[model samples]
Target: MRRLKAESIFTPKGNSVNEKMYVPRSELETAFIKALRKPKHIIVHGESGCGKTWLYKKILAERKIKYEVLNAATVNTAGSISNAIRALTARLTPFETKSYEERKGATASVGVAKGDLQHTRKYDALPLEPYLELIRILYRNAGANDSFLVIENLEHIVKDEKLVRELSSILMYLDDSEYAKYKIRIILVGTTSNLRDYFSKIDSSQTIINRTQEIPEVSVLLSADAKALVKRGFFDLLKAKCLVDPAKGFDEGYLLNAISWFSANVPQYIHELCLELALEIEANNYIITNELYTQCLRNWVQEALVSENTRMEAHLNSKATKHARRNQVIFTIGLISSNEFSAQEVEDSLRNRFPDSTYGKTLNIPAILNELASGNSPLIRKTPKGTRFRFLDPKIKIMARWILVKDEGKDTITVKKFDESIKF
Candidate 1:
């Protein structure tokens, strides 16, 4: 059997849109493609690591549909967007001679595209019309049908009301009859699922929301997809076999479950974990073992968890009392099966993981949960109902599993033998 390099299969932080190990999500693909077929703009939003950027880039490239990507974080205003495009296309204005023809003539050709070529001295103030028309003229002049302006990392600007409102107006303006023929569209990509809510507080939001097609939240991979990714990476591409059973009866196998469980089935996390595992594999034997998996956890933590571990220490071993048991509770909570969990879930987890628990009997689960969420550096926050809580950051959950601390002495704590914890 032919084999390929691990870098090609596992590209967590690179531009590997057409990786052989990619597991397709048909529903998302259908919705996005349909939006591309129509005149409406597109909004693709989900959790931070849910692959929002990758999803659109992959689809756009596959169909030979051209797209220009701009980060909302950098271009936070309407003027900045216009400026960024000017820089991106290497100043689309004419090279020399009469510049107005290249600017206005190019605009006139593209469905009544408008721009104020007049000098600032000619008007009381420089016209804002040019800011909006630059993109229209640039895309129109490029002459690619079915093109896209993908504005990504919108989370950077979601909190600023003025920026959100500015973006809303821009979206509405693009839906004008003047630009109907170009068939160009906007694909807004962001991490927050409630991106539309940020837009709603502005004026005429209903019209703004209606113009953009909402694809279903790009979410974590399902069980089958998660398993497929691991199998293809380890078995199909690398031709490396594992020492453990594939664990095929249920949703995931032993190897896939271990990788998916800690990564929370996030595509980027899965890629990172598998990539590290691939690097650690012995070339001569080509056999993956439990000890290798353990080593990979340490390797991954070193690479990705410096900040997460520091956050864990902020609330760990709360000095109020040694019997507080806050650290253990946090670790147990990391093993949670869902995003939102109750005090009962933590108690249940403690019972399962450490049935011979002296602490479980006298534990005030809810009280401890409250403590973690209420401090100078709170790690979690309660929902509206106040009965359940979740980590303020999702990465905290993964850190829960592999919390590494050199000191387990009188005043400190950490998870030792994390490889064995998977079995328990």
Candidate 2:
């Protein structure tokens, strides 16, 4: 290479990397489309960087459909529903009001701003029925075939029980309203915890739960898919431009071995791991040999450790809080170490340790487990039940045991070994 271009190498550039990136399985999109075409409601949960949002966007773009997208982060209060309604209504229908007509009629309608005819309380207030009517009128004006409303990151609503209850009730009401009969569908995308936590609080959610389609279980990428991911990122993107050529030749077999150790067969990680490799090559000019990968991984872990330590220090420095976060820190580390505990088991351990603590009080311990599990560090994995908790990397697990021995701590049993020794 003549010279490394940081902009071209580090940041994805040219010809749209999206074309090269692996598309997530279509089962989720198929189900979502089916739900939209029919009366089905939907909830999709995906980990950070899982491309769930991207997939949703693709479906919206490719399908012959009309839809509205709302970022749940923006919905802070009941009043904010106005914006959600406007977005949804605009998608359902486009409007063209004559300025001259509005000017002529402006004096007759006092208090209503000349350009803000839709700002009436009738549409803004709670039952949300009038808003649906506005959507219908706009749909007619726009000549949209139908309307679909997508709410992203619903964890915001789920965090507040009252808000979740209100949203749930609104959805249920809309489902049956004549206004929604053929022209409307609602899709909710949020963390799994948000769904379960809100539903667990209110008995009425059972109806909503039954009506909605669940995200199809994301399976580990087959060996072929994994290889494709690597080939696209390294051979096609990097090697084509001689950006970060591997010494071992960026072969499919090497990529397969590297990703097989990941917790989930998440397709998105392929992009991230490639990014890490690019950064490493730029910083150290290390050829992408197998040994170089090992070194890169070590550096990645150390960086994660330093970041975690900094976060812990910040929490400790924030002394205004009533609760001491030391227990949480210890619990997080222990949970990471004892990778064998189920969500329930982890909660039970925490409860036993601190009877007064209320962090894990909910039956939705699985959600808590998930939050703990997906770390930037590779020191966690999901159990069979899809609960997240800490577990050491294979090498780190061994080192932990050795440290326990050096410190004279009690019982450094390896759960995998212990399980194997038990009789069936």
Candidate 3:
């Protein structure tokens, strides 16, 4: 049998897994594929690391669909949207065939820069006429071709009313104009809860909202899927040279279980943890045991804590009292066995942990919980039980524990291990 390669097994962070390694997401993939076959616009919204972008790219490429990606992260005004549409037109249509002068003239009226067509100047109002004409021309030539325009990082401009209105107009045009006959789907990708939030502030968003076919939020993988992911990366994909000899008493079972537990079925976390373990194995001459995996996990957790602490201190500019109070809540929450906890439970824990502190004496547990659960980058989420809340990602829980341990000056933190019986 051919030996596997390490890189093939472990995908680096922020990179998409290839089709061979791509795990089908069952119902979600089915629904998304079915939607792709129709004419309605698509909104693929989910948690940040839930593989929304990867899944979309993989499916589109595997199906051999023609699509153009417009990153909305840089889009803050109407002109940027126009430029994005123009750029998409240039790629999908025969507009590039026109002479440089003709292309300049074609874009000049739309506020696009003559010297650099890709860079557009801000417009006081959306130049709808040029975009309509361009879309009409493109669709006319498409001739049964299935193409899509994907706007990624759309959450970036959701708060900008002008951009939101312009986007609504664009969607409305696509849905209402003669171009709708071509059945070109406009895919909006983001980490927002729903597309409705993008147009919530706009009065004319009803038309766009009515035209949308939303894909439900992408979620973490099931245990079986996550196990298969790990198994494929380790036993199947890790090169023979990277594995321990049969004589070595490495406990593969324990390591795999630990990975699945630590990752909490999040694909990105799984890849990251597995890659770190693989590097450790390679460096240590393929000698891996339960003890080594535990040590590795501890080190990884500490490293993550340092990084997260620096980020929070720099970016989260809260008053000293509020900052300390939030940190206390986070650390207290970490000590609990379950991810989900009640405001009362958290309050009690805080009081027990820091009895003399102001946070323990007069903290508004409910308010703090709400803020943490609903903030821009939410660390926790309100559960269906009303007052109960759970960490949005398992990694946050892990980091909180690390923070707790370091603050307490502990030599080691004892993490409650996941049940080992669960397998792929």
> What's the ranking of the predictions by lDDT, best on top?
1, 3, 2
Report the Cα lDDT for residue 311, model 3.
35
Clashes (backbone N, CA, C under 3 Å), per candidate, total: 0, 3, 0
Residue-level lDDT of model 1, residues 1-424, one tens digit each, is 5567788888887765745766788999898888788778898987667677778888877897777777776764535655555455445554522222222222233555565343222223333364345556546665746577778887776677767776777788665766655556778888665567667788888888788778888877886788788888888788887775344322226777778777777788888888898887846466787778767866776677566666677777654443436776886787775667899888878656544443337788899899889977777877534678877666777777765332333323445443333432
RMSD to the true structure for each prediction, in A, is 9.0, 12.0, 10.7
lDDT score for residue 402 of model 2: 19
Please report the TM-score between candidate 3 and the true structure: 0.68
Cα lDDT tens digits, model 2, 1-424, are 5444433533222222364464567787687667666666667765544456666666766775566677777778434555566555555446633122212222335665455332222233344454566556646643766766678877677767767766776577556656565466667886443354456578787777766666653333555666666665555556522323366555446544554333133454444445666566654553455555555544543442334443323222133333333323333344232324576675566555445554445535565445445555433456434444434333333222211111123211222121121110
Note the Cα lDDT for every prediction shown. 0.70, 0.50, 0.65
- Tens-place lDDT digits, model 3, residues 1-424: 4645556666745455566567788778888898897767898977566688788888888887766677886565435687767666666665344422212223344555554334434434434465565555545565567777789988776767777887887888665647676656688988666567557577876767787889867776777788888777766666423333355434555566667666666677777777777777775655565556666676665554444554333323243342366767776786665546899999888777665564325689899888877746777776533657877656776555443332343222222212221121
* TM per candidate: 0.73, 0.56, 0.68
The best candidate by TM-score is 1
Off by over 4 Å in 1: 76-82, 89-134, 141-144, 244-253, 282-285, 317-333, 336-393, 404-424
Give the 10-residue window scoring lowest on summed lDDT in candidate 2: 415-424
Quote the lDDT for 273 in model 2: 48
